[model samples]
Target chain A: MRSHRFYTPWLLMLPALVWLALFSVWPAINTITLSFTNVHQLTGGHYIGFKNYWLLWHDPHIRDAVLNTIVFMVICVPLLTFLPLLLALLVQRNIRGIAFFRTAFYFPVIASAVTVALIWKWMLDDRGLFNNLLQTMGFVHKTVPFLTDRWLLLLSAIALTVWKGLGYYMLLYMSALGSVRRDLHEAAAVDGAGTVRRFWSITVPGVRGTMILISVLIAVNAMRVFSELYILGGATGGVGGQDVSIVMLVQQAASGSDGRLGYASAISVFLFFLTAIPLLFLTRLNKNNQEES
Target chain B: MTATTAEDSREGRKRRVRGTGAVRHPDRKGRSPIFDAPTPHGLFFRYLALIIVLLISIGPMLWELSTSLKSKAEDVYTQNIQLLPHHPTLGNYGEVQNTIPVWHFALNSLTVAVINVTGNVIGATLAGYVLARLKFKGRKLLLGVFVATLILPAEVTIISKFQMITSMGLGNSILGVCLPDMIAMTNVLLMRNAFMALPREVEEAAIIDGANVLQRMRYVGLPSVKGVLSVISIFAFIGAWDDFLWPLLVLQSPDKLTLTVGLSYLNGQWSHDPRTIAAGTMMALLPILALFLILQRYFFRGVAQGAIKG
Candidate 1:
């Protein structure tokens, strides 16, 4: 009976464990191993020690991609982190029709990134709605090349990302904000504090955990951003390939006609660390905060 | 003299109270303070802020809708920016169908999404039940493994996953697309949390009634976590449906392509025609939007709980 009891739990766990091993764990191990070889799609590769790493160190596009991804993350982190909080605050009131506003903000969260990207592409097109509005309003005499220009292309992609992400993060913040005690705000009011003071003193500190979580979430998301850039910039990244994220670089390298699988795997490994390090740092910080509290 | 002084004080107090009442109830309307009552200036600014935020959130999609409805006869390229279609037409939607196999791609997407949802719900439920209810050694370690997987980005493992799928001869098929995503660690964790929160007595009662492990799972465990199951299913459906990169990488045949990938191909094929792309995008959005609208309350609750717990 003891043996049967012990075995039943393992049996229940078997299917999930098998799935994860086959897909996640085994693939992760393979990725690390593949990073050392000069594998191509047609011809199998031999072990080439650190050659891909060496190439990665010297590659200018890799450098550009790393920089662009950092820039994207830096720009998006603040937008996603705070804008959603503000949106949540705005809708957190007991005002009439607040549900409508909340739902409107959350609409894009459920919408597919592909559909979102397509709509934004149309809007950002030279002859699209945005340029049309600008020209009609005498903002610019000539049509602006939003997607064709490198900086503007990056900006457009960032805008689309922030737009799509606002609802998701807003929902997160809203949930966090809901848990905040009403008496804190009322107490602050009784103490003759102004709205801004109450917000800064109470609301901000109240949802600090969520804020940190949001920041880390946004940062991780920024690092892994692919579909937006891919959809806007095409497979080669944007314009002169100036808009390539690190992940985009990996995709281009691995799937390109030359089939630099080893090089791609090296990039993937680099990406893994790049993403993992900050996450580890943040989680440690979260753990410390929890312990202190 | 003391009585006169007391009368004077009472009169002053009455005047003060009446004055305060006049100020508080300036509109002479008894509106419930708890419900629909805010100062006019405050309400103005609040509504203004809300409208602006609402416009910013949904404006682009609404613009897409407008563009999709715009007749081909109207020149969208010119300086004239119309918020509403001058001559609205359903022809663009129909044109999308004629241009590409939109329905076919959608069917592919639905198939992949449904299968993925099924896999995730079944797998996560079983695992979650074990982790939650069953006292097993190494449960903590297993949970840590799951959480670790959650933190790892899909990009890190895509290449190896692709290679593995190809080796198994699952390439260019929906199964290939669904295989890697069958067991989402996050969903399992969510389910585990949900199952753990259920009363212990329910499962104990089932066991006392001579129900075995699987029987307890089917009879007691499954029904209890139906809410979380729905949540997992919804998220799984959305994840598989919106997934672009995996489908793009795995599926080679045009016919095998999911809707998102097919839309990208459509974009490349009809690069200049915004109307067709807009129509297709809108068509793609409708089902998700409808699902969202219908299940929004549950979605909000699930998302909030998931975010907090995970």
Candidate 2:
């Protein structure tokens, strides 16, 4: 009976464990091993110790991708992280028709990234609605190249990301804001605290943990942003592949005409660390913040 | 001095009323204010902010809808931006159908998404039940392993997964596309959280009634977590439906393509025609949007639950 009891749980877990091992764990281990080799998709290659890493270190295109990704992350993190807080605050009211506003804000998050990117691409095209509006409003005489120009391409991608992601992050904050005791704000208000003062002192501190979570989520997403760039940048990354992200670089290296699987694995490994390190740092920072508070 | 004392007492009464959570009379109107209730000026600004946000959020999608409906002769290029089409027609949708095998892709997507949702809900629920209700050694470690995979991005493992699927002869098949994603860690965790939240005595009663583990799971465990199951189903469906990269990587044939990958291909093929692309995009978006509209409350609740527990 004891033995049966002991084994039953494992029996229940068997299918999931098998699935995880075959897919996640094995692939993770293979990814690490493949990163050390010079394997191509068609031709099997021998173990090349750190050669891919060395090439990655010296590769200009990889450098450009890394720089662009960082720039994109830097621009997006603050905008997405803080802007949603304001949105959440605005929508977190009990006023009439607030549900409509909340639903409207959350609308973009339901669409696929491909759909979102396609819509934005049409809007930002030289002859698209945005440029037409600009020209109509006399903002610019000539059509602006939103996706063709180098920096503007990056900016356009960032805008699409922020636009799509805003509602998701806002929803997170809204949930967090919901939990914050109403009386705390009321008490603070009665103590002669102004709107900004109460927001900083009470609301900010109240949702600090969620703020950390949102930032980490945004950071991870910012690093993994590929479909937007892929669709918007015409698959090769717009204008000299200047707007290519790290994941995009990995995809290009792995599946591009060259099909450098080993090199792509190395870039994937690089991306893994790049993502993991900041996540670790953020969690630790959050821990410290908690302790301090 | 009398007037000042009367005002102080009135303020105290207002605070007490708010503290007690009493509903004010309708005639009181805006006499007493809570922290969230903005003043008239603040209300003006709040509506202003909300309108701007609503526009920014849904404006592009509405624009896509408008563009999709516009007649080909309208010339979106040189024409001033029109919120509504001058001569609205479903002509672009027809063009999309003639241009690409859209229904074929939609059916493929539906197949993959349904299989994924069903597989995930069942698999995750059983695993979550075991983890939540059954006491076993190393269960904590097992749960830890499942949770750890959440952080490992799909990019890290795509190469090997692709290799494995191809070697297994599952490539270009819908099952191949759904295989890797059959058991999502998020769904498992969500289920675990859901099962954990249920009352323990209910399961104990089932066990005491001579019901077996499977019986208890079927009768007691599954019914209680229907909300979580629905959430899991919705998420799994959405994830599978919107999936581009894995489908893009796995399925190469046009006939086997999911809607997202097919639409992406269509976007490239029809780059010169914005209306056709918009129509295709809109078509791809409509089903998910309808699902979302019907299940908006559940969707928002699931997101909130994920944010909190996850």
Candidate 3:
């Protein structure tokens, strides 16, 4: 009777396990196999082995994409890491109206990113509110093209990324913050530690696990940035204004009327490797940390 | 008889310790003159910082609200600087409805989102329970795979997944969107965590009562994880509704589009029409806003608990 009971679970699980294998594993294998072929025009393909990858070295767009993605990550990751924790700390206080402010912060998390990029599209125009504010404040004599300027384009997108993303990260940190023992802080204060010192010594170490989690999340999300660039229309070589992110590069490659699936597949394969490296390290780190705890 | 003096001394020490800053932290600085009461400066500064964080976080959304009311020309010129519309009109909403079948897209979005939510709720709960309570083979490996998948960006599997959909003839259909999302990894992990926290004695009692696996789960486990299940429902809803990439890949037909993809079409047409675009954006936002407001109590609490458990 117990044996029969045990068998029922395996029977129930078969469908879900099959679904996972079909959607996730099989498709992943296909992506790997497809990357090895000269699948440029889609109809017929020869398995060209490493030829496609070798050719990638000559592709300037891929290089630019790699550079652009790195630049975006370098500029965005640290700020994204610390800013949310700071915001979470600020709001974790038992202050009046904190709940209202927290809700306000969460609005963008529920809003569509496509819509966010579009709304910002209008706001970042040459005569948009951003420039108008600067001009009104007498900060600049001429309107600054924050969106279109070659130098400022990535920065503009970074601002959007941080704005849209902070609340979600803040929530993650807030949860971690809530779990810290109150007595620990009291003990630190009694030991003559100041606010900043206690925060660095106590709060930072307490939230190290969350820091790792957010790092992995930010790194992965950085590599997959698309909707914002798509809304920007990618001509600017920045975000919506003029700069291009790597995801835009992939979208163009994949969906181009020219049907450069081989090229696109190659690009996707490269990204797969690029993303896999960080993921590998982070997962291992997570495992080791789990074991330690 | 000798115990009276010792008891009195202990009470005096307790009073002194309680009177210290350990019980209630006092701000070293004096209270605000404007408020005319002694509120800690630390608390005041924290509130101020949070307000700024809130503004930066939600400024664009509030901007969207005001921008939708302005005329197209005004958006081009003023952006979001103008607080109230100089001339507020419902013409944009009219344009959105007329230009595209907004209600149709909403219905499609709602259908897919609800179905996906139901599927996730059932699938994740079962899987979570099995992983948590059942001593089974391959459980640890499966859990590891799910965690790994959380870090595997969709772009990695996007093309192949698209191919799978096309091959299965699920492309351009709502089922395509719902099916892939139904078996989400994060929800599984969340459910596992929630199920792990369930008291062990309840299940043991059910076992002793000769309950079958299904009966035991229904009678003992499901009741305890109600909070986690609600969180899963909301997470599934938000993910399905706000999802653009997968829908864009699978559903090409404008008529069969979800709200996110449908809004993209309106946006493409009205790239210059601020009111039309904002109206469409607002329409996309309303259902989610409604869900959040209606479930605000459950939503935040679920978020608070879910983050810790997951």
**Whose TM-score is greatest here?**
2
What is the per-residue lDDT of model 2 for residues A1-293, given as tens digits with 9 covering 90 to 100? 22126788888877788888998889888988999998877677889999999999998888878888888879988999889998899887769899778877877887899999999999998888889888888999998999899889988999899999888888888878877766677667678677899889988888988887887888888888889988998778897767788888777776733367888889889889988976897879978988998
Better of 2 and 3 by DockQ: 2
- lDDT string for model 2 (B240-289, tens) is 88988888878878889999999888987745699999999999998998
TM-score of 3: 0.88
Please, what are the lDDT tens digits per residue for candidate 1 over residues B112-157?
A: 8899898898899989988988887898999888877877798899
**DockQ per candidate, 2 decimals:** 0.60, 0.61, 0.47
Fraction of real interface contacts that model 3 preserves: 0.47
Superposition error at B301 for model 1 (Å): 3.2
lDDT of 1 by residue, A206-293 (tens): 9988898888888888888888988898888887978888888887776744567788899999999898876888879978988998
lDDT of 3 by residue, A90-167 (tens): 777655677788777877777778778777876776786778888788898887876666657666777778788888
Please give the lDDT score for candidate 3: 0.73
Error of 2 at B260 (Å): 1.2
> Clashing residue pairs, candidate 3?
A232-A240, A236-A242, A236-A243, A237-A242, A237-A243, A237-A244, A238-A242, A238-A243, A238-A244
Q: How well is candidate 1 docked (DockQ)?
A: 0.60
TM-score, prediction 1: 0.91
| Residue pairs of candidate 2 with colliding backbone atoms | none
